[model samples]
Target: MAVAQPKIDLAESLLSRHAAPGPGARWAQEARAAAAARLRAMGAPVRRDEYWKYTDPARLTAAELAPAAPLEPEKEALYGDRAQLKLVFVDGVLDADASDALALDGLTVEPLARALATDIHWARDLYGVLEARGQDPVPRPLAALNTAVAGQGVAIRVSARVATPVTIVNRQRAADSDVVLHHLILLEDGAEMTLLEAGPAGARYNTCLEVDLGRGAQFHHVRTQGRDNERHAITHSFARLAAEASFKAFTLTVNGVLTRNESVIEFTGDDAKAHVAGAAAGDGRFHHDDTVFVTHDGVNCESRQVFKKVLRNGALGVFQGKILVRPGAQQTDGYQISQALLLDEDSQFLAKPELEIYADDVACSHGSTVGAIDEDAMFYLTSRGVSKPDAQDMLVLAFLDEAIQEIEDDALADGMRERLAGWLARRR
Candidate 1:
């Protein structure tokens, strides 16, 4: 249950010798120092740790990591053309000129650095919110590492009875560098919002996003990871919902050498709802993992999760999901499913689903399936005048469309479908 002391000592020594907290590291003034101490105390997680048995982080060394830097003026154009409200962070440093704030009513968006200087109470309360509640051991090093050196991110609040969408685009373009830490937080109350996050890399990227929803609030988050072949990227998302609130998150990954998308969601208020869904297409030696943890802590809360993956070439796909219902969470309704399609014998898929419940009144179930292309279905399609490659691609798309079709946004779904289709063509 604990990492070895020698590893902790070594990590601490290396971190102390090479890493220093960034300028204006918010949440806690000495957060990096505090995290370094915590890492020293907790050490790194290993395979023996049940939570980390599947994915290992010990292979990642300090030498493999590098601090993020500021973005250039010319590169700012990439974000401006894609997003309406853009906040750019280069190597963990906020670029004020690259971001143009919107003066929309009932919506507030500002950089975490600025907010920390002005609103210390909110910043302090937000710091370590996720760290204090984590149960896994694998992320101990990552959480501590990110907490210690997280640079400028964002904090946005949508007022009561309001509806607004906030889009965040993160770009990592370091051709020869280390790792970049990106943090983002979104809070809404009786409001509706959308967060569009894009990570394209030529570097290593680790991003942590925290979202809090108040009563009756509705939030939609779409994340896209399309980094270069050599880039390594990981995203950690933590979300909590209040009474009658609805939280929906969608993720699509088509790139990255090694990418992991981890999400932890909690329904803490009665009648709260959450839907977590993702689709990934991997090829050309890419390794992608999607992990989701959902907890029902309040009576009458509900949650649903669906993940689909398509792997080709020598690519690998993994999905690990768990749903827990507490003793007091009566009438909790939770469902989870993960399915993967292997395009070739060299391609691979791993799906694991778990359910732990202490409530007798709760209804929880989980399912997973891993298989190759259905030859009968493909032949049926080919007989209907469909080309061999096109038929196979169509069947793959149809299998994954069940999850994507549940999305409420038509334009977003269409765009994601197009991207998946293009990737399938390349696979063929």
Candidate 2:
């Protein structure tokens, strides 16, 4: 089919602004070219698109980014006290001086640029591979753009169980910075690792992360998007799990003018498990969206999607999730839930949950709810001496606890809870 004229023009215009990846291996160059071609064919997303109808893509795909003032953190950086190998990126560019050495006993971490430059590397089979696969059933043009032009990010490979977590710290120093980053992670059979991310990447940021897990591998991820009220960002995570592999990820979002996160997971091996969850808090002028698609291609695979958002003062929240069980994917177990706690009458929550099952011997369910704080519970708390604001904060925490509990690490979960409490306290 011929590409739409407007879509071709938009893709060309965006590509003209950025240079292609420079001096990479032949395979890598071919991958980049393929991605650019894909973007042009699909075009950038607009409010008219089915998945993007709730969240406008105008600001995210504009030719130029509006300046955003960097907000200084009022508290210490998340996961700063934990024992981890940290890599710092200032304005989306790697800052070697501020980052610890990339070397680890059981892991190999390097810049994406260098990884692509090498002719023979394991990343050849994984980078951009998962993102390309995720394009089916839905087109993600932004992620395709990132894969084609992004020159900064990390590529990690794990061979054995890694005790220390790997953290990527992003800092926005320029008010008008626009960034595009892509990361790849590959785990060998029986390998295990945890990945952490924190900070506001840039005034306008687009990032894509691809993970490929071998049989019996396990990967855990936890991320906290910075509280930059004026920042705008769209992030994508594409993961493929093999037999008996496990993938778990959780994200906590505070304040941002516009933010959207998308996750696509495919179970290629029987008994594989994947869980994707998030908790978001948005106030006036804020918008947050979470979209997830989980495909069960293997028998007895399990998947879960849990998301909770608290919106007030006219803030808007959106959630779109789906589970697909292929014909031969018998005994598949899938669960999905998205809920919103509206603190005021002006706030809005939109949710679309779906299940498409082809196998007869599978269990799948989904639920979404939007409501206000319990007035009776509020009255009881306030009557017992808790201030109105404090009581409300407590209830909000309790409401979000389910999603927060999805994190596998206790210490990380605690840090997330404390951070949520601090955000609430500051607002009060």
The number of clashing residue pairs in each candidate reads 6, 0
* Model 1 segments more than 4 A misplaced: 17-19, 22-27, 30-34, 65-83, 136-140, 160-164, 182-188
- lDDT by residue (272-321, candidate 1, tens digit) is 99999988888876788888899888999989898988888888887889
For candidate 2, the 10 contiguous residues with the lowest summed lDDT are 71-80
Clashing pairs in 1: 32-148, 66-178, 66-179, 68-91, 69-90, 69-91
The reply for model 2, stretches above 4 Å from the true place, is 1-3, 73-76
lDDT string, candidate 2, 153-267, tens digits: 9999999999899999888889999999899999999999999999888999999999999999999999998578787999999999999999999999989899999999999
Provide C-alpha RMSD values for all models, in order: 3.5, 1.2
Error of 2 at 9 (Å): 1.2
RMSD of model 2 against the true structure: 1.2
- Please report, as a residue range, the 10-residue window in candidate 1 with the lowest summed lDDT: 73-82
lDDT at position 190, candidate 2: 94
Model 2 steric clash pairs: none
